[model samples]
Target chain A: MSEELNVSCARPIGSEVDQGIDDSFVIEGAEASKAKKEETTMIMVGRKAPDFSAPGYHDGKFVNVKLSDFQGKWVVLCFYPGDFTFV
Target chain B: MSVDSMFVHKMWDEEELSKMVDGGIPFPMLSDAGGRVGTLYGVYDNEAGVETRGRFIIDPDGVIQGYEVLTPPVGRNVAESLRQLQAFQLIRAKKGAEATPSGWKPGKATLRPGPDLVGKVWEVWKVDQAFED
Candidate 1:
């Protein structure tokens, strides 16, 4: 018989956002215009990951989870878009 | 983890995702509702409003050992991730004395890092004789 591992899932405590928030700001004056730019920087390897504490879904339930909780274990953090959507 | 909420994750798991894997997703799916984590990882496309494909391999001590962020058109390889994880674990077990060569696997001969093995690795590491053990 195979033993099953019970993983805990945390749930967020608020409603989900329906749309993505625009982080850009516009200047009102004619000479104050600036080009719209999308700046992105890659997180370097061999550095500490940013700390995060959020709700996670697992095993038919929601639970509070944090990055620090996995201190002594290897963690593979993958971020993808929503389900049932094209990548 | 995904940007979708827990409810959405549950729905996806029940509807279609669970059948794709052997034992289902063993890891927790974090809900980054506001894209906070995605922005930190630098994979969030503000205009597209979604995180690009990103994979991070963190060690036991919480240091990021490896990471890859790809465009939306590409998918990641799970086999590579497993191989990297196993390689890291092996190096950790060996206390950093041994290093893995290209295409190295368990039971294969590992190279010992030193000045002596710098220019003459071929003498000690024959391709046909390395994996016999």
Candidate 2:
């Protein structure tokens, strides 16, 4: 994501309920908020990938893997949903 | 990788997933439980609360060369990914002087990208010379 838009800064979509607000207005507000969130997303191609460290399951053990650790080698980072599903 | 924990990955591999494959999954499946990497990669859907199908091809310098994000119903083609990696490797080896044409593979003719070859690619590239089985 872009440096300007921190995920932590995003508030819940429909958290605050306005007593006098019309239902359609609330829906429109939620949609607009979602669109704004989507706009802040960054394209990954041609950009330096964000460095990350996470626990990985490899060779029957949980190993700590970092993106920077594979700096000198080509890396294919494939992200799927959950395990044992259609993915 | 999945957002599940390492324990879940182990269980899925041993009990269910690996059985369907020949030798099981060869690559390391990283756990993004908190969706940190997914969020950074712009594949995490906050509303749906799941990571979309995303694949990234990063070069040796850690720069992303290509990426694709698909909806949940669509599955990515592994062969296509391998082909892209091979094409990138070939281009890098040639110092960006040559470019891979469509459906390019190893031992196939690479186009020397230049002003002359801009609009007349079909004239230079024959159907038989394009790809090899």
lDDT of 1 by residue, A1-87 (tens): 111223437434322222222447644554332321122233678877766666766776666677777888999988886677765
Q: Give a tens-digit lDDT track for model 1, residues B1-133.
A: 6678767877877777788875556777777776777886777777877778889999888788898888877888888889889998999899999998876777777899999898998887777663443
With a 3 Å backbone cut-off (N, CA, C), the pairs that clash in candidate 2 are none
Report the C-alpha lDDT of model 2 over B80-110, residue by residue, as the tens digit. 8998999999898999999988768887778
> Which sections of candidate 1 miss by over 4 Å?
A1-42, B125-133
- Candidate 1 CAPRI level: acceptable
lDDT of each: 0.72, 0.73
- Residue A85 of model 1 has an lDDT of 77
Backbone collisions counted per model? 5, 0
In terms of DockQ, which candidate is strongest?
A: 1
